[model samples]
Target: MKQMTTIGWREWASLPDWGIVIRAKADTGAKSSAIDCSSIEELAGDRVRFTLRLSLKSNETLTLETPIAMRKHVRSSTGHGHDRIFVETTLELGGAEKKILVSLTCRKRMNHRMLLGREALAGSFLVDSSVDHWATPRVKKALK
Candidate 1:
């Protein structure tokens, strides 16, 4: 039997390609992870550009562009449905990095900027909701 790494309900992660770090929530209930963004614009040839706010309290931001991995119809908790754009990016979780598909959306109302869904967590982690930020320190050092 192989041992799996356990992660907290919330941890710090980064999209290293864009040099942005965000607090993420591990949500097994969600099938796909999401990132908060503003100014989402669709480009020609199946590409997208958006501005990511590093944190709610920070004025700093990063603009990124990536080819569309796919488009997904996502239903919100309030039963509202939205067509979200999915893009591939490398996410550094704890000390490990992996390429994950993340849907871009407006998450201004959400507590965390990012949500780590089951697909991103599969085979790589075990969630322990009782803990928080177990991977943040390691991720911070790697990002530096």
Candidate 2:
């Protein structure tokens, strides 16, 4: 079996393909990982475009377009079912790198830029709610 790393409720993640290092919160309640994005536009050829909010503390944003991996109907914490667009991206977390499906949504009020859900954590990480920031992002620094 592959050794799994234990992470805290909060940590950092590097999306090397997007050239962004953002803050992430580990949430067992979520079924899939998510990123804060806005102005989502579904395009032809199964592609979707959106703007990623680089960090909670920074006003920086990046507009990107990528092929849609899948479309999923997800229930928010508020219990509203919404269709979420997912795109495959390289996620570097806790010294492990893998392709993970990340959902895009407008998380303007969320505390973290990214929310790491069960699907992203299942085999790679074990989360400890009592601790925070147990693992740092693979990148040197995050956008502030």
Candidate 1 to truth, TM: 0.89
Off by over 4 Å in 1: 1-3, 138-144
Which 10 consecutive positions of candidate 2 have the poorest summed lDDT?
Answer: 135-144
Compared with the true structure, what per-residue lDDT tens digits does model 2 show for residues 1-144? 988988889888878999877878899999998899998999999999999988667688999999999999999989999999999999888898878999999888988889999999888889989987787744446653
Task: Score residue 6 of candidate 2 by CA lDDT.
Answer: 86
- Candidate 1: worst-modelled 10 consecutive residues by lDDT: 135-144
Query: RMSDs, each prediction?
Result: 2.7, 1.8
Clashing pairs in 2: none
Q: Candidate 1 lDDT, tens digit per residue, 74-132?
A: 98767889999999989877677788999999888888888999999888888999988
Best-fitting candidate, measured by lDDT?
A: 2
TM-score to native of every candidate shown = 0.89, 0.93
Output the lDDT of residue 140, model 2.
49
